[model samples]
Every structure is written in C-alpha cells, then in structure tokens.
Target: MERTLKLTVAYDGTEFHGFQRQANALTIQQVLEERLAKIFGHPVKVAGAGRTDAGVHAYGQVVSLRTTGSIPTDRIALAARSVLPDAIVVTAAEEVDAAFHARFSAKSKIYYYRLDTGPVPDPFLRNYAWHLADEPDAAAMHAAAQRAVGEHDFSAFRAAGGAPVNPVRTILAASCRRDGPLAEFSFWGTGFLYHMVRNLVGTLVDVGLGRINEEDFAAILASRDRNKAGITAPPQGLYLKQVLY
Candidate 1:
C-alpha cells in the first residue's frame, strides 16, 4: 500500500536556489527528493506548504511525502535527516491520512521578517537578517503596521512579475514589535502573494525613515498599484515561520 508522511523541516537557505527544482541550478526540492528517493529505494514526491523564495529561510516549513516505502512514520524523520544535504534537516515526521495535503490544506501562514538595526550586525547573523543602517523606527513601523490588521485588497504589495490575476487577499493580523536592536515584523494572514510580506516591510521601513507619512500608509494600500509601495525587502531577512493547517 502507498504510504504518506508529514514532515516538519527547517533549513538555512543560503545554499538553495529556492524550494523548487531547476533544470540549470540546485534547489531544496531537488536535493531533498533525490536524497529521499535514494534512501527509501523508491521514488518520492514532496508537497510543500508553500514556495519560499531564493535566499529565504524557514524555521517550521511543512511538507508531505508519498512513497511506496514501508518505513515507520516515527522513524522517518531521523532516517531522512541522515540522508538530506548539509543545509536541510527533517525535524519531525508522522504518518498522515493519504487524503491530507501540505499546501491546499493549509488555512493560514505566519511569516517573520527580522532586521538588525544596530551599529553593525553579527557576522553569524549577517546572512540571516538584514542590517539596516539608518535604524528603523520601531514605533513608527509598528503603528503603521496596524493599518493592515483587517482585510484589504493587497494589490499594492504584489510583485510586478507575477501572473496578471486579481491581487485581492485578506490579512488577519499584521504587526511589528521590537526587542532592543532586533526589529521583527510578524504577519498572520489567510494568504500572501509572491512578495507581499517583503513589500510591506519595505513600506514600513519607509515609514521608519520618515520618507512616508504613517497616516498615508493606508492610502497606498487603497491605490492597488505595485509602484505605490516600497521596494521589496531582501529575502534573507525573512523566515517562513509556520503553516497552520
């Protein structure tokens, strides 16, 4: 009988081109699938909760695998971890109903963007967070963040390169909080577009720098134009924190 396994994974994505495979480059998906297929002695396909952009990190990324192998679910995580590449690790795995899916079944997603606003960023965290030189005003950013607390059309935050579809999306909770030199923007939403969180961060940073009035932030959202928003924040500063199913 075919077996399915749900996996909780974490990875330092510096080495991955992204979560998806590529014909001309390395990626997390191809690396994981190749290692898994070899270890399980069978072909394996993964259903990830979402596609994380290149250079992005994940602390609690979820994925499900279907295979003909008969390994016990409890042992699957450990076994897979041993075979996965250096940057990727399977934190946990469990048997799931064959009908369950990692992507379509997700109800919400949480993303965290971290910025080091100190004089200098830690060398170790240099690749993990953005080093903002001007120092973001956490108060200004946090206050402006609340404007996105309710549902609104997020076309102003969508990437320009994406498919020409309606950019309407609802964001449940959007807030920015800080701990000393570390500023964090946490977003919980029903869904997000290609570069929604990053663009939001960019706009918040603009608010922090006094380049944009906090009160005018809502007007930007109402504009429904990508050019009306700030630049897309770097992927390194973002982490895919969770997928609520």
Candidate 2:
C-alpha cells in the first residue's frame, strides 16, 4: 500500500542552485529525491513547501512524498541521512493524511533575514548573512516595516518576473531587531511572492540608511510599482524559518 509521508527538512543551501530540481545544477529537492529513490529501490518524487532561491537556507522546510516501500516512516529520515550530504538533513518524518500537501496545505510561513553590520564581515558568517559596512538605524527599519503589516498589494516588493496575477498577500507581523553588530529582520505572512521578502528587506535597509522615510515606504506600497523599491537583498541572508500548518 502506498503511504503519504511528510518530512521536515533543513539545509545549508549555500551550494545548491535552489530547492527545485534542475537539469544542470544541484538542488535540495534533487538530492533528497535521489536518496529516497535509493532507499525505496524505486523512483520517488518529493514536493517541497517552498522553492527557496539559491543561497537561501532553511530551518523548517516541509516536504511530502508517496511511496510503497516497507521502510518505517519514522526511520526513513535516518536511512536517507546516510546517503545525503552533510549540508542537508531530514530532521523529521512521519506518515500523513493522503490529502495533506506540503505547499498547498500550509497556512503561513515565517522568514528571517540576517545582516552583519560589523566593520569587517565575519568569515564564519559570510555564507549565511549579508554583510554591510555601515550600520543602519534599526529603530527606523522597525518603524518602516510596520507599513507592510496587514493585507495589501505587494507589487512594490515583488520581483520583476513571475509576478502573481493577484499581487495581494497578508503580513501577520514584520519587524527588525538589532544586537550589536547584527540585525535580524523577521517576516510572518500568509504567503509571499517571488523575492518579496528580499525586496522588502532591501527597502527597509534603505530606510535605515536614511535614504527613505517611513512615509516614503508607505507611498511605495500604495504606488504598487516595483521600480520604486530598493534593490533585492542577497539570498544568503534569507532563511525559511518556519512553515505553519
């Protein structure tokens, strides 16, 4: 009998092209499916909660797959870990209702973007956080982030390509906090468009740098023009922190 399985995954993502499978590049999904197929001794397909961009990390990414293999559902993670690279790990696995889907069934997600505002970038965090030489005003960034809260058209924050037909999404919470040389931006939303979080962070950073004020940020959202927003922040600083069911 085929059983549906849900997996909670975590990965460094520094060496991956993205979470989706690619014809000519390494990806998180490809690696996971390859290892799963080997364990099951048959072709296996895995679906991810999000197709995280290249260089973006994940702490609680969810995935689902159906298989007829006799391996215990809980042990599947253990078995797959033996063959998977050190950068990737199946943190949790269990059987789920047939109707459950990793992506479609998700209710909300939280993403965190880290920034290094130190004079010199930390070598240990170079691949995990965006490094900025000049420290931005965290209080200003926090105040500006409030403009994104609640439901609204997020076209200003959406990237150029793959624009959604309905550019509306709800932001449950958005805030920025700083600790010495590091600043963390957290975004909780019902759904996010392609590159939305990164663009939001970039614009918020601009506000912190005194390039734009809170009123300007609000105007950008009302304008619904992508050009009015700041540049897209680097993917290395972004992390899929959680996916709520």
Candidate 3:
C-alpha cells in the first residue's frame, strides 16, 4: 500500500536553476525525485509546498512522497543523505496523513530577504545575501513594510506575466531589521503570487533609501498596478523560510 511520507527540505539555490523542474537545467524537485526514486525502486512523485523562483533558497521547504515500501520514516534522512547532492539536504521525515497535501494544505509561509550593507562584502555571504555598499534606513523600511499588513490587492508586486486568479492576500507579519552589516526583511503571509515578495522587497529597499515615501507605498497597493512598484529584486537574496500547514 502507498503511504504518504513528508520530508522537510533545505537547499542552496545558487547552483540550481530553481525549485521547479526546467527543460535542461537542474532543479530542486528533479534532484529530489531522482534520488527518492532510486530508494523507492520506482519513480515517485514529490510534491513541494512552494516552488520558489530562480536563485531563491529554502530552509524549511516541505515536500511529500508516495511510496509503497515500508521503510522507517525516521531514518529517511540518513537514507536520503547518500544520494542527495551537496546543495540539497533532507532535514526531517515522517509519515503524515495521506490526505495532507503539501501545496494546498499550506496555511501560511514565511520568506526572508537578506542584504549585506557592509563596506566589503564577505566572500562567505556574497552568494547568500544581496551586496550593497550603501546602507538603507532600517526604520524606514520597517515602517513602509507595515503598510502591506492585513488583506490587500498585491497586484502591484506580482510578476508582470502571471495570470493570477486573485490578487488579494493577507500578510500576518512584515518587518525589516539590521544585524551588524546584514539587513534582513521577513514576511509571513497566507499566500504569495509570482514575484510578489521580491517585488515587495525592492520597493521596501527604495523606501529605506528615502526614494519612496510612505504615502507612495500605500498608493501602490491601492493602485493595484505592477508599474507602481520598484524592480523585482534579485532572487539570491530571498529564501523560503518556512511553510505552515
């Protein structure tokens, strides 16, 4: 009988193209499937909670596997470690209900964007955070981020090409803080459309730099126009922090 196995995944998106499978490029999903298929002795379908964008990383991504074998789920981490690449790791595994759907059952997600405002970007963190010599005002970014709270039409921050069914989303928390030379922005929301978090970060960066006022940020959400927001920030700086079921 096929039982549902839940696996928590973490990966460095610097090398792979993205979470979703691509035509020729490597992806987190493809890699995980290949390895899990080998272990299961059959190709297994791995469903992820969120398919993060290109260059985007994840620390608490959740994926599910349907397998017939009766391998102990607690030891799945060790079994997967042998085949998984250096970039991706399976942190935890367990048997969840068969009805649990990784993507559809998700209640909320948390995303983090890291920025390095140091004078010299550390080689260690260069691939992890966005490097910028000029520092942004933390207070300003924090203040502007608060404007996105509650339910609002996030069309201004979505990707231009996506045909979203709904633009309304509820943001539970949004804030930016500085730790030494690192500026980290975090957002917890019910759901996000394509490029929404990155675009929101870009606009918040502009606010931190005093380029956009609080009124303008509010206006962008009210306008529900993509052109009103700033550029889509690079993906390397963003991470799927967690997915709440």
Off by over 4 Å in 2: none
- Candidate 2 structure quality by residue, lDDT tens digits, 1-245: 99999999999999999999999999999998888898877888998999999999999999999999889887888998898999998899989999989999999999999999888999988999999868889999999999999999999989898745789999999989997678999999999999999999999999998999999999999999999999999999999999999
Instruction: State the lDDT of candidate 3 residue by residue for 89-185, as single tens digits.
Output: 9999989899988898899999999988888888988779988767889888999999999999899998998985698999999999999989999
TM-score of each: 0.96, 0.97, 0.97
Kindly provide the TM-score of model 1 when superposed on the true structure, using C-alpha atoms: 0.96
Residue 54, candidate 2: alpha-carbon lDDT? 92
lDDT of 1 by residue, 1-245 (tens): 78777888889888788898878888888888889887678877888897998899998889888888877778877888788876898888888889889998899999999998888777877878888878888889989999987788889999988887767777888778887778999999988888899999999899988899787788898898888899999999999998898
User: lDDT score, residue 237, model 1?
Assistant: 91
Q: In model 3, which runs have C-alpha deviations exceeding 4 angstroms? A: none
Query: Each candidate: RMSD to true structure?
Result: 1.2, 1.1, 1.1
Candidate 1 residues lying further than 4 Å off, grouped into runs, are none
lDDT of each: 0.86, 0.92, 0.90
Look at candidate 3 and tell me the lDDT of residue 37. Answer: 83
Residue 174 local lDDT, model 1: 77
